[model samples]
Target chain A: MPIIQINLVEGRDDKVVSECVREVARTVSRTLDAPLASVRVMVNVIKPQFFAVGDVTKAESAAQKDKS
Target chain B: MPIIQINLVEGRDDKVVSECVREVARTVSRTLDAPLASVRVMVNVIKPQFFAVGDVTKAESAAQKDKS
Candidate 1:
């Protein structure tokens, strides 16, 4: 079984999320030649405060932007 | 930066989920000799209905169990 896990910053529309899950499973199955029914896709939508880049969290960066 | 993604079936306490994320980040940082500050951990808690095994969803299996 092939498991695909995706991490995304929260705030996407539900429709986009649904399409993403479906498309990713389809693409992975096709690429790996695995059965579509056996593919599992798990998505994690993280809050901005929980995601960071270069030691600055997305929430922090947003706040800094507001100050400038 | 090393990113670690974990997929877990839902129904865990919030405390446990927090601890899991923290411990996993620490372990990955230690094992990979990476800076803890530079490591990122993402946890995906999937709904039972969306997770499957052998083409049977967890929700479906549970329903079957209730029927028996």
Candidate 2:
């Protein structure tokens, strides 16, 4: 079996997480010809300061507030 | 809170996966000053053919057999 792990800042609703997992999994499954049953997805949440986006932590979600 | 997503090929022993999670968590916790409890880790495994390493899939594990 193949598993995929994705870690991102928390706070996203279950819908968002579920959508992401489905999208990535679907893409990979189609591209690799792997069955959906064989694909596994897992998520990890970390503190904003613990992750860096372009060398900057998501803790600066405030700064990015206006960007997205 | 922040979450990071890492997607890679499956088949790694639990020890390797455990070490990876622990190391990444430890590093991020220390660097960002987050407590270990705040860090959540999840793993997903993708079929070798589903994942690309430097533009190549891990399915070529045989070709890479002699490399590592």
lDDT of candidate 1 over A1-68, digit per residue (tens): 89997888888998999899999999999999999999999887886655554344556678899999
The regions of model 2 sitting more than 4 angstroms off are A61-68, B1-68
Backbone clashes for every candidate come to 0, 16
Candidate 1 overall Cα lDDT vs. reference? 0.78
Model 2, residue B50: what's the lDDT?
Answer: 77
RMSD, each candidate, Å?
7.8, 13.4
Q: Is the docking of candidate 2 incorrect, acceptable, medium or high quality?
A: incorrect
- The local distance difference test score of each candidate is 0.78, 0.61
